[model samples]
Target: MPKQAMENLTESMFYVLMALQRGDACGAEITAYAAQVSGGAVRLGPATLYTLLARFEKEGFLTDAGTVGCKRYYRLTAAGKAAYEGERARLQRCLDDAARAEITAPASLTKGDARDETARQGNRLPSGSLPVL
Candidate 1:
């Protein structure tokens, strides 16, 4: 079966959009900025960077700012900025959920302990409850 297309931004896509947040950048500059901003955690290869650039441009999320000799500069359009912000908000929610879960969970319970408890309870609605449509 064919893999379904991603509906949300991937980590690399998020970083690439972020790299263009400050201003227009060439492919190499975007990669460098992504690495620098991520504190060396995210690195974009040449192929992946260019491919994203092309896709973003085609999607109307980015615009060609200009070209300098062999390098072409790209900047985020309004849609791109919105997409970046949306991804940022989604990531923040994930972090917040993890933090809240950690704080509320008993210290003695290992990560697996919580899962085991839920499994023991069974994956079912309460006896008198009807599933929401």
Candidate 2:
């Protein structure tokens, strides 16, 4: 099936919406929020940030909240909140699903036998991350 925009919010997309939960924010503020929330896991640089902001604004998930100089501000719409909350719920379910199962990492993965075990599989989960079966 052909994909639809925002069908599944990317980590960056989710963070953009989340960053506006408190109030309005500029591009820089949103990027900082994403980095803070993801423990530096998700970084949205200018190009990526503006691209997402444009897409979100186009999708009705966000609205322009005026601008200061060259910095444009945005506010999360009701739709945006719904999208963010939906992603949150979906992630919670993932954790719940993982919790109900057992994870066993093979020696190869545990010993970092490969170039980057963590990158290859979630078996040997990195710090602050979930494991793969």
Candidate 3:
């Protein structure tokens, strides 16, 4: 819930935040949607997922919109959505720059995986070497 905690968010936290970016959702629904959107690569367990949700709610990044049955629904607050958008944009640039490099490269390099994709390319610095604007 603290600023430092928010800044140090994990990938699962990011996925949950991204899932709630578009609309409100209950806990189970949020998890389901996140898994679907991520092509089943990221699955959020109940404890870890809800803890992050609670922290985000406390941080003012999310709004608790009450419950349906046993499910607690949440909507991203304006701040939460903005953070998600910022992360999304940053990730987009990473993808775009990597693609451009691959296209213009003299030879093929490692494909996929952010670290591998952005690893130093023959003395060329990584795109994310500088702070994202």
The top-ranked prediction according to lDDT is 1
lDDT of each candidate versus the true structure: 0.86, 0.84, 0.80
| Cα lDDT tens digits for candidate 1, 106-127 | 7545566544665588965567
For model 1 the TM-score comes to 0.75
Per residue, candidate 2 scores C-alpha lDDT tens digits across 1-110 of: 98676778888888888899989999889899899988999999999999998888888989999989998899999999998998889889998877654365455555
Name the top TM-score candidate: 1
Worst 10 residues of 3 by lDDT: 107-116
TM-scores, one per candidate: 0.75, 0.72, 0.69
- Candidate 1: stretches off by over 4 Å: 1-6, 106-133
Residue 18's lDDT in candidate 3: 82
Superposition error at 14 for model 3 (Å): 2.3
- Rank the candidate models, highest lDDT first: 1, 2, 3
List, residue by residue over 29-83, the lDDT tens digit for candidate 3: 8888889998998899999888999888889999988888888889899889877
Residue 67 in model 2: shift from native, Å? Answer: 1.1
